[model samples]
Target: MVLNERYNYKLSYSTRNSLIMIDTILKNAGKLLVRLSAGAMMLTHGIPKISRLFGEGPVRFHDPFGLGPEISLALAIIAEVICTALIMVGFKTRLATIPLILTMLTAAFYAHADDPFGTKEKPLLFIVVFIAIAIMGPGKYSVDGLKKKKRSLF
Candidate 1:
């Protein structure tokens, strides 16, 4: 009767709301996943370089910019480690992405320039992800979003 119809309507409405919430969560999660995975992976490469930079030995590294090994390693760490961390936390995301994008460009064009396409593929993928993030921006589930919310409250 009328009671059953009301119950069905309420259930459908609740279900619709649930679906909307899940969609939102998934959307944000996608951004988070990209940030985390890219950052973590870059860290694997950066961390060892960091150790190498500080390790006791002649800094033997590719001097793509003619900047010595130390400088090159420093730049790589800044991009791969620091900027990646910033991107992961969604703090100054766009600015952070700049360094990462640059690093990938360097890797693809210079470091792996003489190598085959397969050697350059990894950096290319990072470049695409960084570019996508730069375009889309950090989602609502981010530190940037929190800052925005706070600003709006003022």
Candidate 2:
């Protein structure tokens, strides 16, 4: 009887551990999905602005915070392009989300302050996703994960 109980206990413990590992993998995959989708979508917005930044005529961008149109556009490009790329690869992901959150905040609030809810909705959604990423940090399937593994070997 004692040997039988020990075998049952071990089986249950092993099953519990397998479930936990599976849960962790699913969570990491979800995080990777969020990062990739957000980064790719934001790139669509940022890429168009690139032409406007260097094109012939005046800058003609939203000048929130009195920073001048060109400067505001430049900052937007940095956040939407560079920071977003970092987040997508899960490299310095939390740090990357900061600029994106700020940019989306500025867009949803100051830039579109007077606009209807429809205009504000997209930026607000981006803000939420970025904030979530910031809180969660990069997950297992990322550049950050590679760095962590390398360190663990040492």
**Highest lDDT: which candidate?**
2
List candidate 2 stretches off by more than 4 Å.
1-11
Give the range of the ten consecutive residues with the poorest summed lDDT in model 1: 1-10
lDDT of 1: 0.87
Tens-place lDDT digits, model 2, residues 46-127: 8898999999999998888799999999999999999999999999999999889999999999989999999999999999
CA deviation > 4 Å runs, candidate 1: 1-21
RMSD of each: 5.0, 4.2
Candidate 2: worst-modelled 10 consecutive residues by lDDT: 1-10
Q: Write the per-residue lDDT of candidate 1 for residues 1-154, one digit (tens) a residue.
A: 1226646534466677887899988988998888888888888988888888999989988888888989998999988888988888999998899988988899999988899999999999999999999997888778997899899999
List the pairs of residues colliding in candidate 1.
none
